[model samples]
Target: MDWMHEHELRRVNQIKLSLPSSGEEALAARERIQKRIAARRAARTPAAA
Candidate 1:
């Protein structure tokens, strides 16, 4: 519904507004994201013989 789309847009805008603005905060965010990606990749990849 149109209301759902509008609600999601507002949520996305709020998230954008809350994002870290400092370099250190940005670096910490990047590290957390990388760790999550690595964990997901490790889970999906088959073990070597």
Candidate 2:
């Protein structure tokens, strides 16, 4: 809902740049952020389950 559309979430989820270079940069940044989030999520999951 509204919480999911927050600025930080929008920024991480979408690449809304005007130039190609800018878009690439945003994509790279988003990837890095996503990797970190994924790593954290994985670490939180229990291995036995």
Candidate 3:
């Protein structure tokens, strides 16, 4: 179990290190995240104010 956790941590760190530093890749990722959040909000029912 401890070994699995260490392997996962290392994998996550490697993925983070490989991510885009700046420019279009980062911008696109940000935009996609924003759109996902907006979609989630739209899907939820609004409560009476």
Cα misplacement distance, residue 29 of candidate 1 (Å):
0.2
Models sorted by TM-score, best on top: 2, 1, 3
- In candidate 2, what residue range of length 10 has the lowest lDDT sum? 11-20
Residue-level lDDT of model 1, residues 1-49, one tens digit each, is 3667887989988998788768879899999999999998898786641
lDDT of 1 at 15: 96
Candidate 3 local lDDT, 1-49, one digit each (tens): 3666887989988998888777868899999999999988877746422
Looking at model 3, the pairs that clash are: none
Q: Looking at model 1, report the run of 10 residues with the lowest lDDT sum.
A: 40-49
Off by over 4 Å in 1: 1-21, 47-49
Best by TM-score: 2
Cα lDDT, model 3, residue 46: 68
Candidate 2 lDDT over 11-48, as tens digits, reads 75566443468678899999999999999889888774
Which whole-number lDDT from 0 to 100 does residue 43 have in model 3?
A: 73
Better of 1 and 2 by TM-score: 2
- Please give the lDDT score for candidate 3: 0.82
After TM-score superposition, the amount by which residue 11's alpha carbon in candidate 3 deviates from its true location, in angstroms, is: 33
lDDT per model, in order?
Answer: 0.84, 0.78, 0.82
